[model samples]
Target: MIPSLDWLLEQADRKLKKEMDPDVIAITRAVITELAAEGLPVGVAQAFRTKQEQDALYAIGRTRPGKIVTYAKGGASNHNFGVAVDVFVYADGGKRAEFLAPPDPRLKQIVAAMKRYHMQWGGDWGSFPDYPHFQLYDAVNGQPKPLLGPRYPGRPLFAGAERMDRTLIRLIQKRLRLPLTGQFDWKLTQFIEQFQRQHRLAADGVVGPVTWRHLFGFQR
Candidate 1:
């Protein structure tokens, strides 16, 4: 017997609410709803993970006894930033969780649902395909990218500054989907202003701690 849609959705919601970013939560919920409507026993296997949890998973193949499960270490995975999730299908009368690979018709359906939300699927990865993984995509490349925590400097970053932290500038540029030039240029400032307006922050074209938090999807 297949799992009831309510049971699957309840499980998914519980996991997703643990630490998932709002955008990730929304997309994952939509995917689960769509697949479950089709009679697929879709469920979330993993959601946002702390750095310690990520490190433990990383050690599974290297130091622990298990097959290699992931390539990212602590702070390197999208999961560490609440942007990624691993989903599974219920089988054996909803008692067994199954990860589907390519050529599986149900896997195809799940992937389609994810794509509807502009999600990036690990199954589509060229190397080390992870059939159970999906993530929010970067706007610039439409690919999964790790979201680092806010690495704020002491002062605000603004255009026309004599000197700036190139690394932080690049990170902001990446988040804003601008050219990753690592320079505080006028164009980048404009984009920052736009983002601030969209998020209801001050449209001052300055990147401060608050702006940084918003840019990286952190709770204020």
Candidate 2:
């Protein structure tokens, strides 16, 4: 028996709610709903990937035996930050997923729906056109930046770190109203410590889950 669109949407929502950022979840749902209204069977294929999972995917065609499927490694893709999702078209009575490439007519409608929600379609990429991918966009000077509050980096950030994800650093700097140097410098550390102290948190100049929650106004 063919699954109904309501059932498909419910399954997609269950997947989307797993680890996706709240704002992305809303926009994805809205996009899916709009497409469904037009009788397009679209659903979420992947969302909010972990760094380890991303690394494994990156290994494809390089270390692993499959074709190259992704360009971004761990912590580099928007999926790691919960701001990206890959969608698929339902087929075979909604029992199979079809990741259509470009030059397909349905892709235009899907792109339009994603654009309505301020999302950047990977299909539009100049080099690696990923037709199944969509991500929220907030560019700065022609560089892509995440649009939602970033998920915790799974580790504390402090001064003297070898390397840090510039996106998170920039978000922290913006929140603190400091220079957007995208660095975990001593000045940024001091500001984070001060903000922690003001919020009755530990003043250790570290950005862990608790401090991150406070920094981004997350309740949990």
Worst 10 residues of 1 by lDDT: 138-147
lDDT value for model 1:
0.80
Q: lDDT for every model? A: 0.80, 0.79
Q: Write the per-residue lDDT of candidate 2 for residues 71-105, one digit (tens) a residue.
A: 88887888887778899888887889988876787
In order of listing, the candidates' clash counts read 0, 0
Residue-level lDDT tens digits of model 1 in 142-203: 45544545646768899887578898899889888888999898899889999999989899
Best by lDDT: 1
Query: TM-score per candidate, in order?
Result: 0.62, 0.61
| Candidate 2 global lDDT | 0.79
List clashing residue pairs in candidate 1. none
In Å, residue 220's CA in model 2 sits off its true spot by: 20
